[model samples]
Target: MYQYKNNILSIPARLLYQDWSLMSYDTYKKKCDRKQLIRTQQGKGLGNEAFLSYADLPHEIKSVCLDKIGRPEETVVINLLEPFIIPDSKASAFFSNHRTPEGRPLAEPKQRQKSINCWILNAVQLVFEDRGMTGKMFGKRKTRIWQNISEAVNKLDTNKWNHTLPGAAKRLKEKYENYLKEGYGIFIHKGEGNQNTAKIRGEVADFILSHYALPIKLTIPMVLAKYNLRRLEQNWPELAESGLYHWLYEPEQERIWTLARHGKQAWQNKFQHTLSRDKSNWFPNVYWAIDGTKLDWIHFDHTTGHKMASKLRINVLFDVYSEKIIGWSLSETEDHTDHFKAIKMAVKQAECRPYLLTYDNQSGHKMTRMQEFYNDLVALKGGCHHAHRAGAKNNPAEQLFNRFQQQVITKFWFSDGQGIRVKKEDHQPNTDFITAHKHHLKSKEELSPAWEMAVNQWNSGKHPHFEESRDEMYQHPMSLREQLSLQEIMQHLWVTESQKPITYKKEGLTLWLSHTQYQYEVYDGDGNIDIEFRRKYVGKKFIVRYDPDAMDVYIQLCELNAHQEKVFVAFAEPKRKHIDIPVLMQADDKMSWARDYAVRDIEYKRDKTAFEALIARSGYSPSAFIESQELNIKFKGSMPKKQQQKVDAEEDEVLLRM
Candidate 1:
């Protein structure tokens, strides 16, 4: 507590020190050594005799004290005459307990503080005016009071409050007059609803928005300049360019502006609402989605030293369930061949058949040959196929391709990348660096390894729907019914178009294929000929369909249906012949001979059993059949009656021989 007596303030030493240091009692004692303070008992000085001196204190400190208490000289005089009273709150306090006439606290503390400061300066002016201080004296008094207040306000936290200098007396007076007229309501921030006060409004704002929101996307300054020319003709005030800019960029208007400036496709790709799909229940290899995208990388041929601009497209086949890239093929253009190669790779990599294959309806995918190939795949693998419309997002490969491009392709520095719907001119690669490093550019063949590495990395990552890596998820076993051997899948990958009919002979079927004569024997996964196939199609002309890459095995003897579709008949192996000389026979020849003899014995026994069974069923003995055949059953038309009767008698004898 502070006390005034004998023209000296009898302030407690701790109280004075506490106020000066703005610290707790115990902290003041420990950190500042309160016993060493002036007028302390330990110093042998007059204790608690600290008197106030306004001139001795800094200007900022004086101003702050005046706002908190009152003018220094009068405050001291009042303290001496009557007990001093503290203000409801300190000037340095941020949150004021005072409420406005509207029963709401001031919306902005800075605004309230600014109004209070102006009021203080106005009070100083009134005092001078009441005393008849005019001209220089009045000006000096007003300046002095404001300077004191501002200096003290500077000591306080000025961040939240405006630190307006004391020289702006005219502005301060105007603010004080507004406060008197409007009361505390004037301190309420203008941001609450005062944006209606913006200069660009009505027809001018509509004109600017309409012009700016055009697909041309006219600049704000350009629109403003045009509007100003119109205003000059109409004798209306021209709006400032910055004012129009601020209004146009407001949150309420920006969305409409952007949507109109850009097109619907851009809006849909970038800002449209999306629904997430849950694929956790899906099985690997049951559903495959394929799509093609132009790679971001720049490729050029080293031999020709010319860039192959926009010549590369990567067709990717991925398991939609596991999110694993099973296959991908790179080509100079989007063609049916690339799609076929990609499908082939996926089949070989997964070694399984898919139940449903989804692809985009690109021109390459709609080719008659491609359609037939897809039909063949479905027929062999037992699945349906679907082709989505252009720009349809139903294909998972589209999303997977985007992820691969952004996450994997962007890591390569030379990759020329851009966001979706971004103009190429807005985001282009460093052409100068590319030109300087032209020698380092890779050809299509060289770029393949990089693509392979990226695929591997993508497969190695954890799947979003599973707790395992994509490769692990893809490796999980699927139904055996949907599985196929690599050879079986490859057999259907090649087109089954017949070159020419070939005869099925006693040894094998022979055809002139790929500029060479080749013999393929009916294998049926075992020996040259099974009993049923030999009996049904022996000596018949058939078409041979086989994959060139796997010509050693997987030859198919097929028959063409009414629709020109290949109907599989039997699988065959390349015919192998062996020399009969025992001394000259190699190990392979001996093995081949052993297999042939074993298979032939089985076939002979089967045929013999079938022959005997047929004879028994017919109730015919072999001796009886021979005796019956000895009698003549045929007679000439001009033969005598006795001869005819003999012929009839011989027929009866043959019939009765059973």
Candidate 2:
């Protein structure tokens, strides 16, 4: 009693092997053909041996097989006769009648599937249709669709089709939405009303639809809608209180929040330590670097005169170790004397002798007096040397000046607190108003000193790199303490040597000293000398031991004749101070500063013959002689206006000449 169920064929009962007997006969015949057998045997055998018919084989293989065999029809027949034996039933089922319980037919058996380009086109058409669009619409209206398809095909060829498909779909959607949005022209408009209060929300839905590539959860319309709802409730309160909207719009607020969060994190990570201790060798000796900078005086008392408007030069010396200002001096002039005074003050204040004192190669530094001072210290064995060749980068002292200008000077405004009372402007009609406000603005005074004090306070308060205040760090006790007084220490640190004179030979009346020749003669009672008796390079000035009773001016000269020439000898004027020439010469040996090293006998008061002999032997140019005199005087105190003007003019002339 077999019952049929809706024309369904049951597996096994329906006899899927109906053609088995015929297939076996055909397989037996095929097995006899060697060509067909070899063809079936090719490739790795998974299990089943399903043969490809010669007629069904690709054209490429058929052509190659025919060429190899040398006869097209025979080769085809031989290849067709080859039989491929099926494996065990279970293995055969893999390529044959494998089916599930649903009893649907398995895939087409052992026949290579033909590639259908039309079928691919159909699948593409179906895809477009599913999106409520057509291929024509995609290609004609949106050119990117065709581009995307080409790109997808390239991806498919490269085996990267899996990733490209989804991305391409997303990009296409975004492009289409953007096109429509731009067509409608929806944008955020700013400053539309009085105090920017009028708000118009128009075509927002269309905008969202056009810009649909944006994440639905992050859509601008959704955000704005919520914002507007909130604004409605707060509008009255905002208008009543201070009349300003405090809430910042989207992107700007987000940026500010992000920066603040990151900034706080960075600040928390910062740490401080003692820079001096971190690098011990950085400050081994007390190297005080000295320099001066001019700071402008903005507020000047007009009554002090226009000269008061001149800038002040502030000299400062910094101890390189503690970064403390060891010395400071303020002067109205930028001269060598002012610089020396500053240096003296700084030395007196520090009390600790700096092993090295460095300053720029300014005229003041190269002056004879200053150089003499350095030489004197060197003579005393001080390890002192001028940092003559330091460039801006090598000198940290100059950096401090830069810091002062940048940090302090540039930040303040100057003002004088003094008030003034003056007559008001006379007006024939508005007398009452004019009389009511009769006071005048007061004159201004310099506020730089106060500003400087403020800077000192600031520097002492906290250091940028160091954990402690500058004062605290400087005052902190250390293992090493300086043992020598500042001056003595400077002397100990310097290298010194005696200068040897360059001499020249002359026959007649002059003796050569330092390349210059001077006539040697004993002054008569009237401080006069016989020009004919003058001794030249005679070594005649040598002291001779004589009996005290027989002491007399010894004259040694080659006298060819008794005729005498009266030499007008200039004696030290009784009222004038007598400068011991020898003492002055010895003073040159230990110069406190090079500025005071005098070149002797520049302007001779003796006879022209003596002067000419001195000039010729010394090789002293008149210009150099004049320069030496001009350089020797130390100008101190404030000069009168006329004198200062003259000095300034002279300085300009000198600079121009240079």
Candidate 3:
């Protein structure tokens, strides 16, 4: 069989590999006068059997994924139906043929490889059937498995399979034969040369492994020393000097692994054991991941006054669906207040409440106040979930914080290296010689731009294989308006709640908090805070909400389940004003004198006279009216020169008449 007009294989790739699982095949065929045959022969003629390990495949093939050690947990041989391209051949110039609709040619072999990877999948319709010893030598489910293949072959669509049968067969035969010679494209036996001469017996291999592996890991040298001391393994060469180094490092490392505890000491010492579980949710505002990480660079915490002995912690509330940093807070402590503030910002900015929130079992996340905050705002339609404390595996927020540190935090002028920041090395700040540089440390308030930059960069980065940025994904096209309105969210979910006792004062109700008097105007004129609400909730509680900054305090009488508990009657700051002393100067001095006299005369008479009657008819003496006269004189003195002179003349005339 022979065909060669151009360098193109001109044959269906599948037909060549149809007998791949046969284990052995003998073929003698001629194509272009090149004979590539693999015949099974053992015993005297062949000293060793030519066997290809099913697991290992070259990197050029994407159908198989395996570790560098040439082992796959299970064989993953996807049956591909595509034209085979041998790049070194002349027909390989067809590269530019694969173009986007925009008329852009694909990038070299990688693009072609991706096309193959995308189209090929595990064989679905193909299943091998073996007939028992009774059936004809080797009976299999050939008919069912190759219906499509047979149909395609008979139809012989040149568009689909552009290659001739003999050409495809030659292509497969050549590749297969070359692979066998190359040890199935994987390095099997070594370059050890004479290095592997120090023979290790099976029993000694067991002893070495047993000695090397312990609950607390020992260095290779220490392990080797322990192994030699046992005297069970004799004639053992030093590990480094021994050619078994490669074996000990990787492939046969299991010999050492059996006796060693894998992460045994750390596993024992760890406080929390994490188990993985699926945390996937498809809807927007359905899953919120919250976690906090310490920023590498220091910031001055005025509360403690040391240049941030505890560095600033960046708390993030990440939307898992969009991979967006929806909300964040930079705080001195991983306080529940900061946690609430972060979530409050997210809820208000996102305008939707999360049905489920995931957090780690950190002290901040575990606070009773934090739990209450979630209860009051989160609705718990889907309950709260917590990950194990130490590992960030379950918390996507932690992952985002890692990204934040790398992209945003480490870029700062004062960046101490974010230790866990991946892919950015050699940027870690050295503290040993740089202690005096603490003066260059920025204050907590100064890093406002850094936080903004973190969010901007985080949401602006283009997602892999997608046209949209993280911010675009966050503005989810599929999001539906939630049942809860902004009003409801602001009332319950948007604000932090505090419970405090209201003292009933004759002036007004004063609720003491944080050493500041946050006075509130009673919503109902009936004095609910002092009497009605107080009587019902005295020694009980009421919900108080403040802004994210905690600058404004708002007390509310909320009963969400009862009638309109979702609604809140807000108590705002009492609007205060100074009395208009200028306006009071316009009043008559005679009226002021009469009122002062009536107050004393009325007190002596013990009469329930109306203030209107006293102003019209009361008579008085100088002693009772002295205070009012003095106040009149002071009021007149504050007026403008011309006005004050006129008022003085009138006051003097009034005093003379009296």
Name the candidate that leads on lDDT.
1
Q: Tell me the alpha-carbon RMSD of every candidate.
A: 39.8, 46.2, 38.8
Best-to-worst ranking by lDDT: 1, 3, 2
Candidate 3's residue-wise lDDT over 44-159, tens digit each? 35454222222222233213222222333332322222232223221233433543322456566544443322222111111112234212211234433244333322233344
CA error at residue 588 for candidate 3, angstroms: 20
Query: Residue 255 in model 3: shift from native, Å?
Result: 86
Number of the top TM-score candidate: 3
In model 3, the runs with Cα more than 4 Å from the true position are: 1-285, 300-310, 363-369, 372-392, 419-427, 432-440, 464-467, 479-483, 494-553, 557-658
Clashing pairs in 1: 60-151, 60-152
**Superior by TM-score: candidate 2 or candidate 3:** 3
Give per-residue lDDT, candidate 3, residue 147: 41
Model 1 residue 333 lDDT score: 66
lDDT of 1 at 125: 42
Q: Clash number for model 1?
A: 2
What would the per-residue lDDT of candidate 1 be over residues 446-550, giving only the tens digit for each residue?
888988898898999888788999999987876644566767775568754343667665456766643556667765555544545654455566777655445
| Model 2 stretches with alpha carbons more than 4 Å out | 1-285, 299-308, 375-382, 388-391, 415-455, 478-658
